[model samples]
Target: MIHGILNLPRNIWLIGLISLCNDSASEMLYPVIPLYLSSVLMAGPRALGIIEGIAEATASLLKLFSGVIMDRTRTAKPWIILGYSLAGFGRPLIALAGSWGWLLLIRFADRVGKGLRTSPRDALLASCAAPNQRGLAFGLHRAMDNAGAVIGPLLAFALLSREVPLAHIFLWAIVPALICLALSLKIRESAPAASAPKRVAFDWRLGDMPLVFKRYLVVVALFTLGNSSNMFLLLRAKEVGMPSEYVPLLWAAVSAVAMIFSIPLSALSDRVGRITVLVCGYTAYAIFYFGISATEKNTGALFLLFGLYGLFMGATEGVEKALVVDLVAEDRRGTAFGWFNLTTGLFLLPASVLFGFLYQGISPTCAFLFSGCCAIAAALLLIFFVANRRP
Candidate 1:
């Protein structure tokens, strides 16, 4: 397995390591933030939804423009480096947050960094990968990323067990984040001659793209409408009597499962076809959400379902990325990734707000039920509209 992964280019490995570090820092902060917002900062669930939704929405909007920047410059490294620097440095500012508003500002900055970097980073990865090995390369990257999540939460758990203050832990995230930044700076861009021909101006119209790509984006938007913040899942676990201290462990468990499954499942996509794996992934997500919705305060069931949720993530995350490369021209890769992320991000805010409303207005079960139904609908659309056309 190690030898298979090592067959990819050196830059791919470097980017993977960079992702490992970056995700480590992000995950270390993630499991703690909701609790901090609600418990320590005295915010409510709606506030939590608003903050997360807006942060992600900010990233999405930037992604729409960032793609054009990448396409015009025909370079990804500089943008990538700057984005990582901002995200890494900006996130620790949460330690100084005096109120939920302050936390919102910090999250917005971090997500802005994400918005700037994500498309370029993905374009960089695709550029580095061989056509035949794109699936394996992306899968390996996601696996490394998930591995970092596993380590991050365990470290958080260990620190909290030692009674370390949460603010101190938040500050410590800078260590890995900065390390990722340094590693990111080391990635050498392929020569410009290898890139798509320079277009005179940026064209933002979806009509110019392949019909298959547009259809895929529509399916993605539909799916994202149901996919809210994972924080809600963590909150659900807490509501079911999982202790606060063990929250990191629960996160670690989910990441561990993803780490274990991401690479192999992604490789399976390379063999079987990306659409098949994606359809299965969507099915898994629906089942997981429905299961969670139906189970009432059962910690054991929640743990199992969270692991299943991880499986859902493992199957789709990298595979979907690789699929986009297959759908567009090489020169348009950055733009394609940008649009994909934008559509997903566009729906993210309303999706999260809707989930929060359903949870507050009716019940958590209703939110999950709504999401499950949407996932099922999106899966069918993928089968008819996108998958059938491609495969």
Candidate 2:
């Protein structure tokens, strides 16, 4: 099995490994951040919203520029290296933060690294994989990604349960980050072939993207508008009376399900079609969110909802990236992915903030209901408007 993975292209496995390490590092920190803010820092829902909004907003603003810069320079490896290193260094800062403001700065720095690397890294992965196996490539990457998510949080649970300090957990994450950096250095760059022009004008425009890409972006934007921050999900679980100690276990369960399903769902998308898998995933999300809204304080119900949410994530996230590559030309994939991230991420701020307000003003259930409605609308739009248009 190890050799089989090794037989895959160096770039493919390397990207997977990098994702594994980075996500492990991230998962170790993310689930606890909101809890820490509320419990330790005395922040309210509004402050959590602001921190997430600012972090994602910073990431959104940088993606397009990062993609254009990577394309123009005909260099992806250096940026990838820098991005990962920056994110790795930034992770520890959260543990050291004295206030929500400091935590926001750390989150912003980390997201900046994500914005810089994501498009170029995805383009490189696409370039590395055989066209027929792009789904598998992305799926394997996501599986490995969530594998880290599983390990990181479980580790957090173990350490915290053993009376290990949060600062120690944060500092320890640097180990994986360093591993990722070392692995990244060994992965060969898959930059697009440079033409005789030496440098090309940065003429990539959001308006100039293909119609299919644009339509898909619209669908994603709509879905994301409802797909508020995961913090809300944790908060919902808490509201439903899940013990604070059990929250990480709940997250671990979600990651475990996502890890198991991602590769199979991605492979299924490869065999069937991406749209079929994505539409199904979106419909599942609609139902899952609706369930979250309608249900009361039942651990069984919350577990089931989280499991379903994981399935939806497994089916959609990596498969969506593969579809983006399929719809765009090889040479322009970096720009395409950048624009996609930019559009979706820019919407995340408003989504999270609005949901936070709804949760505070009306009820948590109301926020989830709103999200469910948006998802259902997006699913319907995709089914009616965009499903049959691909060719």
Model 1, residue 19: distance off in Å is 0.9
Q: Write the per-residue lDDT of candidate 2 for residues 244-352, one digit (tens) a residue.
A: 7677778888888889888889878888999889888988888898898888889999999999999998998889999998887666777788888888888999998
| Tens-digit lDDT track of model 1 for 1-391 | 5677878889889988988998888898889898788878998778888898999999998887787678777788887888888999988889899899999999999999999988988888898888877888899989999999998888888888898888888999889877987898798886678555857455567755789999999999999999999999888888878888889899999999988889999888888999899999999999999998888767788789999999998999999999999999887888888899999998999999999999988999999999999999999998988887873
Range of the 10 consecutive residues with the lowest summed lDDT in candidate 1: 194-203
RMSD of each: 1.4, 2.1
Each model's lDDT comes to: 0.88, 0.83
Find the 10 residues in a row with the least total lDDT in model 2: 191-200
lDDT of 1 at 188: 89
- Which candidate achieves the best TM-score against the true structure? 1
Tell me which residue pairs clash in candidate 1: none
Off by over 4 Å in 2: 1-7, 190-205
Q: What TM-score do all the candidates reach, one by one?
A: 0.97, 0.94
